[model samples]
Target chain A: MNNMEKIQELRHFLARYDLPQDRPPLTLGHPQADAVLGGGLRPGVLHEVFAGNWSAGGFAVALAILAAGTKPLFWVRPDYEAMEYGAVSPNGLLELGGDPRRLIVVRTRNAADALSASADILGCPHAGAVLLEIGGMPKCLNLVAGRRLAFAANESGVTVVMLREGAQAEPSAALTRWQVSSAPSRADDDDWGNPVFDAALVRHRAGGLGHFLMQWNPEHAVFTTHPGAVVAAPAHRPAYPQERRAV
Target chain B: MPRLPTDRLIRRNGAPSKAPLVVSGKSGNALHVHALEARAARLGLYKGQPLANARAMVQPLAIVPADEKADAALLEAIADWCDRFTPLVSLDAPDGLFLDITGAAHLFGGEAAMLAHVTGLIAKQGFAVRGAIAGTSLAAHALARFAPAIVPAGGEAAAIAPLPITALECDDKTLRALRHAGLKTVGMVAERLHSELSERLGKSFVTRLRVMLGAEEQPLTPRRALPDLMAERHFAEPVVTQDAIAAALLGLAQALSEILEREGRGARLLEAVFFRADGKVERIAIKTGEPLRDPKIIMRLLNQKLDALADPLDPGFGFDLVRLEALLAEETRPATISFDHDENARRQIGFLVDRLSVRFGYTRVQRFVPQDTHIPEAASAAVPAQDRDFGPETWTLKRCPDDPPRRPLRLLQKPENIEAGFPLAPDGPPKFFRWRQCQHDVARAEGPERVAMEWWRNPGLTRDYFRVETKAGQRFWIYRDGLHVQDQLAPRWYLQGVFA
Candidate 1:
């Protein structure tokens, strides 16, 4: 057969085996980020949102995207994460536009239970999305577990976000991997202005990657693009001195 | 309807043997026979006889302690198993079951065939029982225990006429009184004048006599509520495969849905029972958030429940009958023909929650419900998300978006202790605080919102909270546990929450 005919035949074969078309992407509401992601982050697939520094910025960004959906969300974390790193604050989450009433917090004894719960939550169509916060990726969440999570998420058409802390981007079955760190707010007065995050599209299954500075506007209830700064060699270090140390 | 009675169920729970066995228990100071096997009874060994006397009369008699709990549990399990024959099964106390198979006997061919089937099933399970069918439970019970025969329709009086006076289940005093009066058999009692019997034996004897003769009706109280709606199918051949079970469930669901639709009602709770040929019954229950009459949704929920069961639903020796029952129902009106996409979407969400809760335990899924208390920790509670009433009433906040929220989004379930420097003023916020060894210098402070403890509810020290923003732009809600009025008592500060 000619090259064009062979190519056409291959395309049809790929189409037959492609992921289910029922689940579409959930737009992050950030233009630049969405552009980098081709269109938007695909729902019904596992995605990792990690922070080089274990700050609240990464979780804030996750909550911003989660707030756009009308259905309830499940946030599964290890019980120790709550005891040691402080629990989620209802006021803080409310300020971030995440309705605390619509959020279900599941605290498991260990990472394995959290991941299992995450998979369970993903399979629940009632849950618009699920955010799993793990201290780090353990050996138990290997490719097999990832595939199981992916399959469950896809079947239910629910977005699954894994909030990883102090972990490197490891090889797994996740569709996209992001690195978020706290960035300097634009306001000068000490009123705790809008929250900003230096976000990087570290990995993408469909392939284009980029970095951007995103600001969460509580007034507008959306994430707006900020002027990107020249990131340091480590990729997530604070841009200015004042932003370096936040407790 | 048939009723089966046993003197003692203990002998049936443990190992079965043909040898004469007697279960002994201590009555006051004397050890007496609590129950006996059929062979023991044939050998003239009776219950309530002193163990010493029984042993003296019959050497090498098998004796075991009576366990009433175990016997009762076995009886309950058997009653559950009897659900295959009829859903209306009730315990007759001690060791008896009243099964109201009024409309169900024909499913197994006929009443006679169903009785034979039950006796064979119970016998195979190593339980020796005598079952009888009569118009009334009193006659059925009397025939079951005394003669172990079926009393034909309208033959209640004839059935008990030959039974001994002891079959009346009266006290020994009453029996002695009856024997003294020359009434040894029910026939003699039935032949007595009603006025004479009442004057001589008291009103109670007359009542018992009338009940035994079917002149007075006694009702049977079932263990479970009679289902609001039920649909069942009896397989000609036993169905063992998962596909067959699924198909049977779908058929039953369809049948049940039609009934529900016709009644203008919908089911909220449904139970599916798999009655195995070996007399084992396995049941799965599913709950829905809203009234549902769709067979497809019911089937899908059941499928999820069956898959998620910890103990696989084993159709032991294959199931002969499958039944679907709507345990709870609600009045439902036909939906208005509209193009409201949001309603459909919300319905789908509710279905998803129900399905998820079934798979991963209902308690594992939860929703935050706002409570009345002002205490930050007690302001909201996590209740099961699948709770039917988890709606806007418990979650919607009264404050508008423009109004500043008095509470934080995330309040620590337990306030973490933090070391804070003494403020410049008695009610001012701390200048610096150290939490988890990380120091934060407060650059701006909001207020000293003094909240007093509710006096009626274990009143304690009042708290002064402040919304403090650190130099790095992170806001934390810190509170001083006690007031600063006492010089000797220095209030300790704790970080209670954080703001975005």
Candidate 2:
């Protein structure tokens, strides 16, 4: 075909189908438990997660958001050291086919500016998600500021994730509040290596709650499902000897 | 009255047609002319006599030359001084001023009170002045010259009735013609038919008369209008030293900050003027990296700016007045302070960058932003350091992986063309290449990463880039032009950058 004909063909091919619009909904590690809770966390609402011994769950949630096709994720974590999180590298999300330019890490002066910037980002329609590290926020930004930020997020169609430092009993404007903790999946012996405890979802929006067992593969920088697993009721006996004694 | 000669000799041998000055051959042979009829009567001189005979009749008469420029300059100074009452003062002519004191009247109690105040002030300066108020400037001008000091609204014609034809400011020839025509007052001229008036003396004369009677409205040009954002501080006593000026600036900055905070905005550029007591003024200005309303921070920035001023603030006498104005403003959200040490360090870095930018010039400091185009030169743009918003760039090297790959430490400002042959080209690495009369040899070589220019822009050339290691283990990025064609010129080579 001639060059002009080839150009016309390319244009016709491009106009054949519209681009895909489906995006994966947020995957709250314990799917069954989250399903029991009201249809997973509300799509575009603020969710507050209080930090515990293992801060890795928060980092996992951040990656999940990016993997869900959320473009331009604003990470406003002042106290959480990005380097320690193991995904602070510029191309950390490249394995997921994510655009490196879409990830923005803002090193704010303090929790105040971080919260303010998070609110501003949430109010902007172009933003896909905003993660506010209000672990060290001043007392001034308590309930009132949180409600304002939530309103802004709702109006702009942006998801907000607040990373709290310590255990807080109540959340002002969070649609779903969860507390994450670490525990072993099972006591079964695996040939590969010793079974380490996978982070568990101890609390959720609805009354339902559970835990997931997973093994970390540092070499590939990812986590895989444990070989053998056991599911138990909320008050069931601990599977590990050490966990049972502690309980 | 005494009988006076109508014709007399002006020069030694000629008799002029116009009236001449009387002169006396004896007692100094002085020439004298009667300017005022009262003075001539007092001096025993007749009106129609020749100057030679009049001087013979009256001795020791004084002659004074007229000073027109000095009179105009004095009038201009009076207009400038009138600024104290209102900034909208304008000079009407050589001897008149049109002050638009509509809103300014209340500042001095009322309109009549303002008129009395201005007249008293000018009278104190030893000048004879008259002022009239009317809706239109033309009407005001005519009334101030011929009519009463205060003309009732819409009564311009009646107020100017008894005045002579001179009040119209007609030329000498026009005045003589009017007098010859027996039209002695402005009221008489106003009564004449408009068509007849225009045919006899042209349209301008009639137009001027119409304008003076409020038939048309005239616009007044003011001297100074209010600025967008201004803050002024008047000290109890004049200050001279730079320290005093700096202290006063703090107060002004606080005032400006309060206003900006109330309006939910911040200033980007600010200018400060010092009106010295000795009639001299000094001005200094500064621009901030971001819009800010913090007085302490703004004062600190201004202090650095003041230190960088080329001209020293001597304050020769003292400065009694200081004014601060905001030239540009923008809405900004206040930042919160963090307790984390690393985060604090980052904030400190932003401040240091702003200071260094102010000292080195904004354009000199730059940040790199990646562009989407494939062309090497079009892949990045250098933006002002202060204006850069920190974020990841979208574009990447075509062959490079999405990792922290090694890159050249320094990129040449511009590419240099070279001719490579023998050992340097044709499928072989160079043993030695001459660059700036210095020879360098290749120790290792990496492949040709092909990069093509954007063809849509214009006719483009393709490049084949290679990473070559020298004997010293220093790697250099070099590229070659389009490959050889049967009828085209040979390819050229250039060294683009060096990796540390």
| Candidate 1 docking band | acceptable
- List residue ranges in candidate 2 displaced over 4 A: A1-247, B1-226, B235-237, B332-353, B392-399, B402-407, B417-431, B450-462, B485-492
For all the candidates, what are their Cα RMSDs to the real structure?
5.7, 22.8
Q: Which candidate wins on lDDT?
A: 1
- Quote model 2's TM-score for chain B: 0.58
User: lDDT tens digits, residues B1-500, model 2?
Assistant: 01011111211234333333332222234434423223445567754345666656656443222234554555566665565455467877556788887777886788788888888766554444577887678878877766546766678877776678888888888888889999999889888898998998889988888888877666687644433466777665889777788889999999998988887788777777776654455667766667777888778777776775667776877777787777678887765677886556444444544554554456533445666665555555656656764455554433233321223323455666654544455644445555545555665556576788778885667877776655433445677777545465455677765432
Provide a comma-separated list of chain B TM-scores, one per candidate.
0.86, 0.58
Candidate 2, residue A210: CA error in Å? 55
Residue B98's lDDT within candidate 1 is: 86
lDDT of 1 by residue, B1-500 (tens): 11112334433355335446788878898999888776677788887899998898876787878777877777788898887778899998777888998888887798788889998878766677778888788788888888877766778998899999988888888789889998889988889898988897789888888888888887889888788999999988999999999999999999999999999999988999888887677888887877888999999889888976878999877999899999999998786655786666666666766766665667756666667877667666667667744366444443356333345545666788998987877668888999878998887777788878888986877888887767654667889888877473567898887654
Top DockQ model:
1
Q: What is the lDDT of residue A216 in candidate 1?
A: 65
In model 2, the clashing pairs are A110-B338, B21-B51, B22-B50, B22-B51, B22-B52, B23-B51, B23-B52
